[model samples]
Target: MTRDATSFDALYKAEPDPWNYETSAYEAEKYRRCLALLPRCRYPRGLEIGCSIGVMSAEIAQRCDSLLALDFAQTAVARARARGIPNARFEVATIPAEWPAGRWDLIVLSEVLYYLGPAELDRTVTLVAKSLAAGGCCLVAGYTGPTETTLSALDVQDRLLHGLAEAHPRHAIYKDRDASWIAAIFECRTCPAGG
Candidate 1:
């Protein structure tokens, strides 16, 4: 099953920096690699799923004309908003159900997909394929370490890549895997109409 908002909210309430996003060297390096993997230096529009407390959102905002960052937990969203990223807007939203309308030039799914159930993951993959603009890119990154969720990090990336292949050609600009994490950047060379 997908991890519920209540559980995430409780986690944030218990610890403002549950994952130490702001202070962890591991996260800092991960974010660095993620930012470096982007094919372009700037994007007109961007979306970041599960932005947590906006540590990465602040960095992404520097490269985007406008960015929309989402987290289901109200507490997490509130914390992200408090960062006051000028070009980024933080909102409370759950994926595959509350996906924002319109195409995105860049969409990032960092350390979030494994929390989803199979069906939710499938739906999310479809949503991503349909919502990406032509020449747009989607970045998927996650911890390869053991997880309590139904899908492993690699499983989530593989399923998303498989589903996207059906909708559009996969042009992987970057892909990397280490003992701790795996990340890939898939570009949509040509999107179907209305995407």
Candidate 2:
């Protein structure tokens, strides 16, 4: 079973910025590079899951016309909202459950997918295909490792993601340094909505 929203709540109850993405230089640099890869920086609509505190969402807001940033924890969502991303909407939502309506020009699963189980991952890939705008890109980035914690893990997300790539198409991947991290970009095939 994937760790449910309640577990994430417990995490936020412990620390508001658990990973320290806002203050950590390493995380800030990573976000900088993540934003740098946008083939079309001016995307019409962008969606990101696990948008802790919205630092990256703020960065993405600069590149896209509108963005929907989500996290399972209310505190995280609230903090992200306070960041004041006028063009971005912050919601407390869990993936593949509250998958947003309307096609997305860019979908990001930054540092979050690993928490989901295989079943959730499979469902999420399908949701990504359905939600993608024609020629839209999906970026999945997370900590790749054998850590004791769940969800923060990354490695095999690439396999699950790639196995579905043939059906989705426009697939491309880029990994950060091998030190327990990886990031990739994928584009879904032309769906009816996108077409």
Candidate 3:
């Protein structure tokens, strides 16, 4: 089953920061872990999908020459944009369909992939493979615990591993069960290896 815009809209309608990402300790630590796991210290260009409220986007912008953060919900995008980070841009765009132009040294799918079905996630993976700069990496983080959503964090990582097999990607898994989240960093091997 596809989780559509309405579900997300209702979420945003209830509260600006529905997930408490701005104040949650779990979220703060997860963001820290994601940043720590990056192979490179700085990325030339980075794209963060589903960057709700720009809480993490602001942090990530510090580590990138340029960053674009996109969310499907307009409220989320608006909240994220309000942060006013100079190096980061926020937009409303649905993934695998309204992708931005140009490749990126880093593409982040944080806590968002479980909202999709298998086929849609497959399309998203394909887009990541095509949009990623050679030797660039895609970092995917998600909550593994029970949720209303159909897919789990483990399911999302499994799809990435099997679907991107042709690209010969290098994978790193990091988990904090207490925080109920897991993240995987996949570095594409299709191009000449570079940091």
By lDDT, who's the top model here? 1
For candidate 1, lDDT tens digit of each residue in 74-161?
9999999999888999999999899999999999999999999888999999999998888888999999887778899989999988
Q: Model 2 clash pairs?
A: 114-151, 115-151
After superposing candidate 2 on the true structure, give the runs of residues whose Cα lies further than 4 Å from its correct spot. 149-156, 170-175, 188-195
Off by over 4 Å in 3: 169-179, 189-195
The C-alpha local distance difference test score for the whole of candidate 1 amounts to: 0.90
Clashes of 2: 2
| Tens digit of per-residue lDDT, candidate 2, span 1-195 | 456777778887799888887899888888877766666658899999889788889988888899999988888888899988789999988887888899888888887877777777778877877777777777777776665544454544665476547566655555444466677777554554535
Q: What's the distance in Å from true for residue 60, model 3?
A: 1.4
For model 1, give the RMSD to the true fold. Answer: 2.1
User: Candidate 2 at 68: error in angstroms?
Assistant: 0.6
**Pairs that collide, model 3:** none
Native-referenced Cα lDDT, model 3 = 0.81
- Per-model root-mean-square deviation over C-alphas: 2.1, 2.7, 2.4
Residue 186 lDDT in model 1?
A: 85
Per-residue C-alpha lDDT of model 3 across residues 52-137, encoded as one tens digit per residue = 78999998899899999998888878888888899999998888688888989888888888888878889988887777887777
List TM-score per model, in order. 0.95, 0.87, 0.90
Total residue pair clashes for candidate 1? 0
lDDT, candidate 3, residue 47? 98
